[model samples]
Target: MATIGRFVVSVVGAGEGHNGRRTAAVARALAFISALIAFAIAGLMIFDAVRVVNEPIEPDQVDFRLVTGVMLVIMAAIVAPLGVLNLIGARLLGRRKPRGRTSVLTGSLLGAVVAFMVGADAPVVVWVSVIVLFIVTAVAAALPGTKRWVRGAPSPSESGELVLGGVG
Candidate 1:
């Protein structure tokens, strides 16, 4: 049990003292990439849904087409919001705000949930990629390094003195 706890802590990078700035940068990048990928996927889903809806359907196939198109639209709706959340999180992280980490983490978890919910409908590769991306993003945001960085810790400078009084 203790070993498990230790491993979990290490995985989350708790206790600080690591290369926070770099870790935060990595987290920010991951979030942005995840957002872009999600947006792309959502756009594709929407396009496909529109195509399905516009297709000339036989009388017997009308229900099937409508159901499929609606499901696609619903999935796209779910995915797009997560992408927006991730985008917002990335922007906030760029500005060095602590809430950015929370936003990224939240977005990641929600995205994972959405991926799982729609797993059967999506291709294996697509769902797997989404899951992996969200998990990595969440882990990055949860890292102690990212936490420290987002909290605005001073970086080590050449003389080890905190630099103050810069641009107005």
Candidate 2:
């Protein structure tokens, strides 16, 4: 019974190391670049908001700018932390840690929500690009090899398990 249980555990375990060195390298690069871009955009939005607020304008225009600035502030709040998390994740990947799935997921979901909320007001191309970027980043973080590396587990085929001692 114990042997059978052990076999079951091994068989049911998830596979690892599906990603080659090149793939992992690409993912790391993408994650890092995405993080930097996110942070930069957030900073720019903050600056724009501040500039809009500081500009002298009529009361009616002020109300519209205030609303836009507030929305930009909210977007920055969502994006800045995500950028930090992605940066940490990228560092971990560089160190062969690969432990950033949660951060990736969170960032992806938040980005999707933000895109959906603001996409209606933006051009179609901009909306599509944002959606695609979010998807690609999320997928890169959840790749099979990435998960295996993050969990520090060996691939199933490399575990040296065989059915019935190679006689089955």
Candidate 3:
């Protein structure tokens, strides 16, 4: 049933119509590149995290667990709230629009790149996950007619950057 519906929507140009399909194509291309970086970083972080947890620590050095544990907690705290909001924004897509969230996500993504380049200590995986999700969240949150979507007041969707209003 869902497949049938999707087919119908696809025929009719549901999301972006042909543009959406094209966007998907481009997104996939981008994702192919991004997912590699993401997975590689994640793999490295996992190694670091596991090492921190199981490795013996010197009496003079800070406990890796303490640091990693702190990182996980902090990551959870930050991601959880945004996750909820992103979910809500997702639900609102096509129902009511808000300013675009993509910019926020884009910023976070850039930040993530910088963060990873900056250091390897702590859990980089969590941060990368959040930023990736931030990109997703921002894009999702900007879906047309979503409460959180921000394209600015428009007579039409023809031209303009998706924008994020002041509030999330």
Candidate 4:
């Protein structure tokens, strides 16, 4: 079941610090990439929203136009912040600080939700890109090293256990 979920880390062994560091690096890279995609999507959506807002009113279609504009605006609003947060979080993660986990997780989850909502309406290429980015972002977050970092555990390299009897 855990394996089916895609995010669960089941691999176990010694010397995971190096593996974790590599995994975190991958996640950071993916987060940065996804952030760029989110920004582009947000910009396009905002443009569409603005166009809808400025379009001439049609008595019969006013409700539909308004609803469409509102939803577009809402999606843009959500996407822009997610992009910004992911960018910042990824930067921090690269610096070996796990504090950005919350931001990364939030942005990824929200982006995934938005992608699902707009998939049918978006172009095939855009839809596929969004899905791929979402999966990559998720995988990064679920990596074993990332989990350990986020949980505030000291990796073996940083644990200073090599000194014998508490002496240098």
Candidate 5:
């Protein structure tokens, strides 16, 4: 268990020298996970929409089926692109690009909106958890430390020594 925990920490970049980089790494992981979840949800939405459209329906229920299927398809359309954005953001963040933070922030905000809009029928706990996940991801990406890290600023210790011309 300890070994697995250590491995997870290492993979997440938690062992890095600076807090900024560590937080940025965490944001990247969260964004990546959120993107995967969004993709899965989008896939399920597409599948459900197809199933609804193909299922046998009584004449009076035709409108109901059509509306439900169309709604699901629309939701899927919204989610899949956001998922792609999140994936791109996560990849760029892993590379320490400044724009990665912007992308991730945008994706996180949009994702939270979509979750709130589409999760009306979901269990309260589940819906809230999804919202919380988005919020946390946004907060992590927006942190000062994360911003500095993504901008490629040297850590304080490194900066101070260089700026002061090093006492020897």
Candidate 6:
């Protein structure tokens, strides 16, 4: 009976072990992509800032401060939320057997679609953003959990038969 309990646990954990490595690697890769995007955005903003600041202040010329400030505000508004979401997702995937990848992918897609659809943003921006988030979320769900299965003795049932954790 004890051997049976241990075996059951081992079976459950090992079932996904092989797949877990590949999936986890994919998640890390997607996360790297997200970081890259964020870096690119930040870099562009910085370049734009320098260009505007060096330009002579003319009425027709764009206000560097205003432009930079607006850019910062927009970046903060959107990136902050994404950062939060990433944190939540990282935490969830931190678990041993993360939930369905479908939910994560569907959610990211729905969010990107609705946000960009209403915002009327560029096609590439919206699509890339959605796809990237989808990939990240999907990969994160395949991370592994604790692989140990504690052995336990079977308990005697009221019917006078050995029962395994309340199951026959």
Relative to the true structure, how large is the alpha-carbon lDDT of every model? 0.83, 0.66, 0.43, 0.74, 0.83, 0.45
Candidate 5 lDDT, 19-136, residue by residue in tens: 5777888899999988998898899899999998888877764357778999999999999888888889999898778778889999999999999999888899988998888888
State, as a TM-score between 0 and 1, how close model 1 is to the true structure: 0.76
RMSD of each: 5.5, 12.7, 11.2, 7.2, 7.9, 12.5
TM-scores, all candidates, are 0.76, 0.66, 0.34, 0.68, 0.77, 0.41
lDDT of 3 by residue, 1-168 (tens): 999988755543345524333333222233333434444544555565566677787899776696885564444344333333333333332222332134233433553554454334547776566456536534432333222123332433333445466322
In the range 1-168, model 1's lDDT, one tens digit per residue, is 999987755655554465577777778899999899889989999899989888886876435777889989998998999999999999988777877888999998898888788766778987898899899999888887888777764443643666677422
Error of 5 at 130 (Å): 1.1
Number of the top candidate by lDDT?
5
Q: How many pairs of residues in model 5 come into backbone collision? A: 0
When sorted by TM-score, best at the front, the candidate numbers are: 5, 1, 4, 2, 6, 3
lDDT of 2 by residue, 44-105 (tens): 77998999778788766436778878988988887777678777777776655645566665
Q: lDDT order of candidates, best first?
A: 5, 1, 4, 2, 6, 3
Clashes of each: 0, 0, 12, 0, 0, 1
Write one digit per residue (lDDT tens) for candidate 6, span 32-105: 44534434544555566566556677798556676665665565355434433443443443332233233333
TM-score, cand. 6 = 0.41
User: What's the lDDT for residue 104 in model 6?
Assistant: 36
Give the per-residue lDDT of model 4 (tens digit) for 28-130. 8888988999999889998998898788887765356678889998888878888998898888786666667666777787778878877678888878778
Q: Is candidate 1 or 5 superior in TM-score? A: 5
How many Å off is the CA of 93 in candidate 3?
Answer: 2.1
